[model samples]
Structures are given as C-alpha cells and as structure tokens.
Target chain A: MIYLDHNATTPVSPQVLQAMMPFFQERFGNASSFCRIGRIARTALEEARASVAACIHASPDEIVFTGSGTEADNLALRGVCRAFHGRKRHVVTSAIEHHAVLKTCEDLEEQGIAVTRLPVDCRGMVDPDQVKNSLTPHTVLISIMAANNETGVIQPIASISRIARSRGILFHTDAVQAFGKIPVSVDDLGIDLMTLSAHKIYGPKGIGALYVRKGSAMAPILTGGSHERGKRAGTENIAAIAGFAQAAELAEKHLAEEAVRLAALRDAFEKEVVQRIARARVNGRDAPRVPNTSSLSFASVDGESVLLHLDLKGICASTGSACATGSPEPSHVMRAMGLSPMDAQSTIRFSLGRDTSQGDLDFTVGVLADAISKLRHISSTA
Target chain B: MAKERGDRDDTGMSSAENEKAQPIQGPVLFYNDTVIDHFTNPRNVGEMEPGEANGYALVGDPACGDQMKLWIRVDSGRITDIRFKSFGCPGAIATSSMATCMARGKTLEEAAELTDDDVVRALGGIPEDKKHCSLLGIMALQKAIDDYLLGRMCAEEGDDLS
Candidate 1:
C-alpha cells in the first residue's frame, strides 16, 4: 500500500534495524552494571548519545533519552516548571502546538502557573515578535514547535529562541517532526531544550530524547535509579537507542538532499490536486514549511469520508492527528488558523517521507481527485 | 517490550492518513456486514423531482453536520415510490438507504411507525456512534408522511416542499 502518513510515524530503516539487532540479543547487559558486558553496553549507549547529540549540534552530555517524544516534551515543560515553581510560574507557547506541549501547559496552569498561548497566522506560523511581547518577568519558559506536524509550517525558532534568551527565559522546541526532515541546530538557534523522537526519523519506536543544553536547570519527572545523570530515571532501551543513533546519523547526513527531493514531490502533488479538484486548496501554502507535508482542504466534503475512501483504495491518510481520529472534535490547528468548522473538518494531511516517490504522488493525486468528486457528488445531491 | 516510538500519539493538531488502523481495513467492524454492504453500494442515491413526489422532507442537525432528505409518492395512502439523499458518514448513507428500502411499499401509518431500531435491525446493527444516523433517516421519513398529510388538509399547499 502507498504510505503517505510519515508525519504520524515512519517505517524503520533497514540500516537502523541492523544496527539495533545485536543490542537486543548478544549485548543485553544493563549499561549501569559493573561487568565487562555491562561496560560494552555502557560504551554503546554513550556512543548513541553522541550520535543523537551531533544530529542537533548538541553535546553528548546534553541529550537525555526518554520513552517517547511526548515524555521528552513532558520533561521539558514539567521539569523546567518544577525547577521554578516557587519563583516563576509563567510559560509561553503557541496555540498550534502538539497536545504534548499544549496539554502540558494546561496542567501547569492547574498548578497556578499562567500560560500565554500565542496565536499563529492564517498560514499557521507563529510571529517571533509575539513571542517577545508575551514574555513577562515571571515567564520561566517559552516552548514552541520547530515545525507543525500537520501543516509542516516551519516556525522562526532561532528568532524566538533569541527573544527567550534576551529575557533570561528558557526556550524549548518540540522538534520531533523537524529534526530529521530539516536542519536543526541547538547552538545556532540558542535553544535551551528540545524534544526529538526516533520513530519519526525512521528509527525504532519507543525511543526519544530531550536535549537539555549545558547549565540548563530542570528537575526530573521520573524518579528511580540515578539514570540519565539523575535528570531522567529508567533503564535505557539499548536496542531502540542503537537504532535511534543510526537513524539520526543517516538523517543528519542526508537532510539537505532529501528535503529538496521530498519538497518537490509534495509540491507537485499539491499543484495537481488543486488543479484537478474543484474548490480544493492547500493549507499553509505561503509559509516556509518542511519539505514533506501537504495539508489540503476540500470545500463541502467531509474529510472523514474522503479518508475512508482513500483507505479503501490502499491509501492511508488522516483528517486530524492519528490519536484524535475516531473522535468527533475538529482539528484544533485548522481552527486556530481561522478555518470554519466545516473547513477544519474538510482537511486532509498528506506527509511524505524518504520512501515516497513520484509514482506514489501521481497515484495519490489521482485517487484524491476521484474521492473528492465522489464525496462532493453525494454532498451536492444530499 | 520495545517502546514503540513511530506509532506517535498524534493527540491533536497533526493529521495523517490512517491505513494501519484495523477499523479502516474494511468498513470498521463497528458496522456489521449488511451496513457495510449497503454503505458500499447505497441504493436509490439520487434526489426525486419535487413535482414527482407527493410529499418531501429534509431533516438535518447543523451541530452534527448530518442531513437527510426523503421523497415519497403517496398513492392510495401507500408509499409507492421512495428515494433519499444523505450527506454524512458510511452509517448515515447506509441507514438512509435502508430506510428508503424499508419504506418503499409500506402504508403511510406503517412508515410513520418505523423507529431507529427498525432501521438498525434491517441493517443487522449499526455502531453505537452511528445509532443517531438511523434516527435521522426515520425522522426524515416520518416528517415526509406528515408533510403529505398536511398538504392534503391545506387548500393552498404549494409544490415547494421547503
């Protein structure tokens, strides 16, 4: 089947799978043990840490592996907020953030921390100046995503990070969708903390990392053995980490070339779909989005029906977040972009990945146009 | 167990085409085979001319984004011809198709007595979330019968069903 939902998760690369196989079997010793086998595991773990750190231009000591990107996001927000719970209790974030960050901020508010959710433009981009103005003396952290998973609209992270730095506030970016698909440098962006997931970058699932720059103070959310330098607790998933390192290395090496290639494919698909389908338009058309995402809104057609039709044709796509599917709520991101409820429900997000090809794009556009017409035909008659 | 990362919990704000989901594999098992069959090949899917039908009704909930229109020809107080147009999910299409099929030759009173359960039973069973879809079809059919009776009682009932 043609898989165009890479933003949800990517298939693990063969290279990553090969790199991780040994850790799950022969090299099964815990990294913290004193035996020689344990030392081998420890060395491998540290090497993986360095590889992940290098992907984002960070130091090895700065990377803290976690169970998932959501956990990494939780650590960044909760950890930072807990550190300043008694002093500063204000946080700044964009309205279009993944639920990981948006919901975490809501939890923080329950603890008496005020949250300023900055709005995005119709193109789904957060203005850097708004980040600057939202800052207060009590603002301890400003968290924004590097790029939206749905719209793929790239945000001005460097500028936003600069604003947070000038005010002595911490900056965190959920770069799960951006890290592998685009170039992300913590040093260049002045990002104090960031979240990355391996599964999104063609690595093993269940392994993600939170990058905490040196000297950034934050408490740990998980309490257990003094693993991850006491910042996070739990025995590391060595196999997943090994695979994550391999994926990160490959992503960093081919980021520029793959981005250009995928952007071409995505743009071609968008152009054709819009041309062939009546009243169908691209979301975030003018924004500087990541190379792999195309969100389209077909007027007067229910996105769920279109998605079901696509699924029936051996195509997989989503109207909202994968988790939010089967739920009746409209996409919050589309609503935040000022789309009407009908328009929000009418959206479909197609994300390309390294595996996507021109043939796949052609097939998608052909099937998509057919589905839209079918749905619109039923709608107009009804 | 390996922590599955790629199965990202895209809670909100992100969207993907979900082919991996079991339900999308084939008519989501929440709907039975009959519902699937009818939804896949919905019957009587076109609108009838307003002048051709003796009674017509349109019912919709703007909040639910579901709407149904039913047209019925009352000859000798029996629904001789029936057609429906629906805009919603698979269940919406299936229920309306089933409703029209069930109402085709029934007397006006018999059609009016049809409930959401009758539609569900005819389609085997609908998913719980789709129970309302069956209700929509039944409500539209009942309203059409009511419209037919009201038009006969009025001296100046026009051809406009709206």
Candidate 2:
C-alpha cells in the first residue's frame, strides 16, 4: 500500500533497524546492571542518548528517555507543575496542541492548577503577543507545539520562547511533528523543555525523549527506580532507544535536502488537486507549514467517505486528525482556522514522507480526483 | 468496504456507463426525485432580517463546531414562511431544506413533533454517520417553535402585568 500518513508514523529505516537488532538479541543485558554485558549495554544506551541529543542541538545530559512522546509531555507538564507546587499554579498553551499536551494541561486544570488555552488565528498560528498576554503572575509553564500534526502549520516557537523568557516562565514545545521534518534546535529556540517521539521520525515506537535543559527545575512524574535521573521510572527499552538515535541522526543529516524535495512534491500534489478538481482547496494555505504535509478540503464531499474511497483506490490518507478519526466531530484545527463546519469535515490530510516519489503523487492525485468526482456525483443525485 | 463494481475502458467509461444506462428497477420510494431536487438546489437559504421574523432560534454549538440559525414566520399559529442558515455539512443543508418543507403550513404542535428520523426519511435515508446533521435541524426547528410559543405567552403575561 502507498503510505501517505507518515506524519502519524513511519516505517523504520534499514539502518535504524540494523543498529537496533543487536540490543534486542545478544546484547540484551539490562543497562542498569553492573556486569560486563550490562556495562556494554549502558555505554551503548548513553551513546544513543548523545546521538539523540545531537539531533536537536541539546546537551547529552539534558535528554531524558521515556516510553512515548505522551509520557514526555506528561513528564514535562506535571513535572514542572510539581516543581512549582506552591509558587506558580498556572500553565498556558495553545488551542491546536496535540492531545499529549492538551490533555496534560486539562489534567493539570483538574488538579486545581489554573490553565489558560491560547487560541490560534485563521492560519492555525498562535501569536507570540497572545502568549505574552495570557501570562499571569501564577503562570509557571508555557507549552506550545512546534508544528501542528493535522494542518502542519509551524508555530513561532523562538518568538514565543523569547516572550516566555522575558517573564521568567519555563517554555516547553511538543516537537513530535517538527523534530525530523524540520530543524529543531533547543538552543536556538530558547526552549527550556521539548518533546520528541521516535515513531514519527522513522524510529521504532514506544521510545521517545524529553529534552530538559540542565538547571531547569522539574520534579519527577514517575516514582520508583531512579532510571532517567529519577524522572521516568521504567527500565529503558534499549533497542528502540538505539533505533531512535540512529533515525534522529539520519534525519538531522538529511533534513535540508529532504525538506526541499518533500515540499516540492507536497506543493505539486496540492496544486494538481486544486487545479484539476473544482471546489478543492488547501487548508492552512497561507500559513508556514511543514514541508511534507498538505491538508486539502473538497467542498460538498464528506471527508470520511472520501477517505474510504481513497482507501479503496489503494491510496492511504487521513480524514482530519488521526487521533480523532473515529469521532464524528469535525477537526478542531480546521474549525479554529475559521473554516465552515462543512469545510472542516470535508478536509483530508496527505503527509508525504522521505520515501514518497513522483509516481506516488501522480497516483494519489488521480485517485483523489476520481473519488471526489464520484462522491460529488453521488451526493448530487442523492 | 464498498466494492468497485465495474471496469474502465480506454475512454475511462465502460461497463459502468452501461450500468448507468440501465433503468433502475425499483419503486419510487423515499427519494423520488423531489428530495434529490431539493438537496441539489436548496431553497430558503441565506440570512433573514432578525426582528422581521415571527420567531427565530439559533441552535447548535461552536464547541460542537456546527450551528444552525432557523427562522419562521407564523401567521395565525401556522408556519407561513421558513428559512435557515446552517454552518454545517451538506447533510445538514439538506436536512434544513427538508425540515423547512415539512414545517411550512403545519401547526406549531405538528412542527414541534417533527423527529430527525422524519427528515432522514424525506431524504431517502441519510448515511448513519450523517444522521446527526438531520437531528440538529429537527432540534433547531423545535426550538424555534418553542421560542414562538414562549414569546406569545410572555406577551399575554405582560398584558396582565399592565
């Protein structure tokens, strides 16, 4: 099957898989043990951490490995909230954040910590001014995603981080969607904390890391076992960690060239769809988006139906956000972008990957055009 | 999964064209051309003057991301005119049109009792997922009628107060 939903998850590259294979087999000793095999594993694990750290221009000691990006987000938010237990009880975030950050904020709110959700403009971008305005004396943490998973709109993290810095607020970014697809330097962005998932960047699932700058005050979210500097409790999944490091290194190395190619393919696909089909348009067209994603709306056609049609035609795509696909509600991202409910419900996202080629783009456009025409005809007759 | 049921020739139209050419061999049931006509070319769309309406109701929620503004002119307790502006899907627009058709000339009680299933039936059965859109329209119509009744009762109460 032609996989166009790489933003959701990607296939593990052969190099990454090769790097991880030994840890899962002969080198299967626990990194925490003191034996010879264990020391070997521990050294490999630390090296992997350094590689991951290098990908984002962060110090090796600052990276804390976790099971998933969601865990990293939870560790960042709740950990910071716990650290600021008495002094600051407020957190600020954007409306278009992924569930990892949004739900973490919600849980914090439920725990009596005041939370402010900043809204985005029509381009799905939150202004740095809004982030500044939403801050309170009690505001301790500001979490905004570097890139939207659905619309692919890149947020102004550097500017927002500067605003947070001026107020002495700690800034965290969920860079799960931005890490491999774009250049994410923690130092350049002035981020105190950041989240990255392995699966989204061609690494294995269930392994991710949160970059917490040294000297940043953050309490542990998980108790027991002093793994990950007592921040996350679980023993490391060493194989996945090694794979994640390899993938990150590859991504960082090829970021510039891959971005240009993917952007051209994404633009070409979107242009063909809009030009060939009537009433088809791109979502967040005016926004600065990631290179590999195109969320297109086909007017008067049901997005779910279109997705099904595309699936039948051997083309894979997503209707709205992958997390909220089974839910009948239209995408909150599109709705927040000032689209009508119809427009929001009729939008499908095509996220290309490193492996996507011109032939794939051609097939996708042909299939999508046929599907939209068929659905529109059915809708008209029905 | 819905099956792709025909072959495409070099012209991109083949047995499918023949399938379309063949006469549909079924009774004219719920969608007997009338519903299709109304759905294809919806009527009474666009905005209405707010105060000029006999009754109006703005229903649905922004949180739900779908809203419908329904208006009606009730003459002597009968719906004389009906119109709606929906910020929803095609299913919603079709349902709104169907609801307006069902409400015209109907008594307030009858219109209030109109169920979402009734609107779906008028459209020859909407897909299960889109059934909520029809329900939204039905609820909006009921709310508008209830608003009209409440307004009349309030006017009577004001007369007694005077």
Candidate 3:
C-alpha cells in the first residue's frame, strides 16, 4: 500500500527507532532523579533539547518538552494569555489555525478573553496589515500558524512578526506542519514562541516541544512538578524525546533536497489530476505551500467517497483533518478560502513523505483517475 | 501555545500501517447486515428505456452529494417493472435498491403510498445521518407514479394544453 497522509502522522524511521531503543529498556530512568542512569537520562534529555532547538535556531534553554504538539500549542496560547490575564486579554489569530489554536481561542473567549480571528485571502494567506488593524492596546498576543495543515498554505510570518514586534505584542506560531517539511527558524522570523511535533517528522508519537524565547514572560499551563524548568509539570517521555531530537537533526540535514523532491511529486500529482479530471482543481494552486501537500477539489464527488476508493486501492489519503472526519460538515478551512460548502465537501488532501516515489505517484494517478471518473459517471448518470 | 498541540488528533492509520491484516468484511460502520447485503448486490438496477417506462422520476440534489432515478413500467394500474440508479454512500445505494424491491409488484396506488419508514423497515435500518436516503427513494417512486398519472390526464383531455 502507498501511504500519503504524512500530515496526519508518519512512520518512525529506523534510525530514530534505533536511537530510542536503549532509553526504553536498558537506560530507563526519570530525568529528574540523581542516580547514575537518571543522570544519563538527564544528560540525554538536555542534548535532545539542544538538537530540537537548533532546528528552529533557538537556544537550548528556550526548549521545553511536552507530551505532544497539541500540548506545546496549548502551552504557547494559554501560557501567554494567562501571563497577561489582567493587563491585556486580547489576542489576534488567523481563521485557518488548527483546532488546537482555534478551539483554545474559543475557550478563552468563553472566559471573557477577547479574540480577533483574522480572515485569509482566496489563497489562504493572511495579510500582515490585517494583523496591524486588528490589534488594540489590549491585544497582548498574535498567534498565526507557520503553515496550514489542510491546504499547506504558508502564512506571512516575518511581516506579521514585525507588526507584533513594533506594537510590543508577543508572537506565537504553531509550526507543527511546517518545521520538518520546510526551513523554519524562530530567531530569523523574530517569533517569540513556537510549537513543533515529532510524529509529523518521522519521529515517535506522544513527544513534542515548545520554543519560548528567553525572557518571554509566559505562565506555566501545567502546575505540579519542577520538570521542564517549571514551565510544564509532567515527567518527560525520554525515549520519544531522544527519537524526536534525532529526527530533527535528520530533517534539518535533508531539508533542501527533500523539499525539492517532494515538491516535484506533489506538483506532478496535482497537475496530472487536474488534466485527467475535467472538473478537478487544486485548492490553493496560486499560493505558496509546503512541498509535501496537495489539496484537490473534485466537483460533484464527495470527498469521503474519493478517500474510501483510494483506501480500497491501497492508496491512503485524507479528506481534510482526521479530527473532522465522518462529520458531514464541510471543512472550515475550505470555506474560509471562499469555496462553497459543496465544493468544500468535495475536497481531498494528499500529503507525501520521504518514502513516496515516482512509481507510487504513477500508480496513484491511475487509481485517482479511475475513482474520479467512476464517481463522476455515477453522479451524472444517477 | 500548549493548547494548540495538546488537543491535536492525527490518527493516520492506512491499511499498510494497520497491524491487524484481516480483510474488511460486512457493512461499513453505522450500517446493518441487510443494508450491506443490498449495497453489495443491488436489486433491479439500470434504466428501463424511456419508451418502455411509462413513469420516470429523478430525485435528490446533486449539491447535497446524493441523487437517484427511478423508472417504472405499469400495466393495468400495477407496476410490472421497477428499476433504479443511485449515486452516493452505501446507505443511498442500499435504500434505492430496497425501494425497488418493495415497489416491484405493487399497484400504482400502493407504490405511491410507500413512505420513507417503509423503505427503512425493508432494509432493517440505516444510519441517522443517512435517514434522508430512505426518504429520497420513496419520493422518487411517488414522483414517477405522479408523472404517469399526469401523462394519462393529458392524454384524456385533448387540446387542454393550458
């Protein structure tokens, strides 16, 4: 079977699995303890932090381990919001944020914290000037994602960062989908806080990190232990973190070449689909996107039907986020990009990974053409 | 920031990644055994030809992602032949197939009086999200009967085009 849903999660690489084997059995010890094995675990934990930090150009001191990328995003949004609870309770974020950010903003709004969700253009891009106009004296944080998970549309982070910087507002980015696939740097973009995940980058699941720039006054979301320098309260998943660090190093080393390779595969997939199917179009065709993702809309065909057919043919893909699957509602991301609900329901996302090959794409092209043609024929003839 | 990743749900399990290598069987989740049977082997499918079918009706909105067409050949006020074509999920296909089975040998009056609940009962039951599929089947059959009656009325009342 050909797997193309890397944005959802990825298979752990052999290299990362090998690096994590020792921690799971022989060297299993809590990083907080002071015994020999514990000391070794502590040392390994710190080294992992430094490696993850280097991926985003942050210092080791700024990295904090969390159970998952969702936790890291929660820490960044709630942590910074709580820090300015009484002084500045307003936040600015884009409409196309992951539910982790969007739903958290909703919960904050329930608690009387005002949130302004800016709109994206047809290309799924947020205007920096819109961020400027949405800010008020109470706007303490501006959280925009580095890239959209569904459409893979890259946002204008640097310009938005400059706006927040000039206004003295802290900037946070949920870079879960962007970090491993592209070159992402917190320092270079002037980002104050960032979130990264391991599973999306060929690392083990249940491990992620948050980069809080030094001196960024963010309150701890979890409160109990002094773990993660008192910023988070749980014991770290040492094996997974070690795997994450190794994955980060590997991703950084191969970023340029992988970007070119995946982009060619994704572009070829999109072009072939658009040419074969009369009513098919790529969702964000004109926008800048990450190399590995292609969101295609097939008019009059249900996205779920396409996904199921592809799955039957041993080609695994997705109909937008897995969280929103099986719920008949159209994707909010597609709706935000000015597509009708019908069009949104007809969209599917195909995300490639390091293991995808030209032969796989060729097989997929044949499978996709058959599925769309069959579905369209059934739709029209019925 | 912690909130963004903490609630993330990316369960990306393809067939290759699935540890259990069992072949998929039975109906999809939310459908029953009978629905699966009808979906796998639909009954009375394909069209009856415009000249052969005295009544025909196409139901459902394409934008809603489901559409069905039913054709009937009536003789002596009884349905002699009923066929259907459906496009959508398994539920849609099952309901359309079941609807044809239910209306095959019934009289025009009986077929027109068939309700969505009757189709659901014939198919055991469908999912809540797909309850409309049953309704579309009954509606198409009723409309086909109506079309037949309308054509008969026009034939009897010559020069009454208005």
- Using DockQ, give the best candidate's number: 1
Residue A315 of model 3, lDDT score: 93
Residue B83, candidate 3: alpha-carbon lDDT: 82
lDDT of 3 by residue, A40-87 (tens): 999999999999998898999999999888989889989998987658
Candidate 1 Cα misplacement greater than 4 A, ranges:
A380-382, B1-33, B61-64, B117-135, B142-162
For the second chain, the TM-scores of the candidates in order are 0.76, 0.73, 0.77
Task: Give each candidate's interface RMSD in Å.
Answer: 2.3, 7.1, 3.3
Q: Lowest-scoring 10 consecutive residues by lDDT in candidate 3 chain A?
A: A373-382
Model 3, B12-75: lDDT tens per residue?
1222322232433444347776676666566777777889999999887543456788899999
lDDT of each: 0.85, 0.83, 0.85
Error at A197, model 3, angstroms: 0.8
* Top candidate, metric TM-score: 1
Model 2, range A1-382, lDDT digits (tens) per residue? Answer: 8899998889999999999999978999899999999998899999999999998888899999999999999999999999987589999998888888887888888899998888889888999998889999999999999999998999999999999999999999999999988899999999999999999989999998999999899999889898888878877889999999999999999999999999999998888999999998888889899999899988867786677657766778898778876567788788878888878878999999988999999998898888777556534212
State each model's C-alpha RMSD to the native.
8.5, 9.7, 9.1
Clashing pairs in 1: A205-B5, A206-B3, A206-B4, A206-B5, A316-B17, A317-B16, A317-B17, A318-B16, A318-B17
Model 2: residues with Cα > 4 Å off, grouped in runs: A380-382, B1-162
Error of 1 at B15 (Å): 41
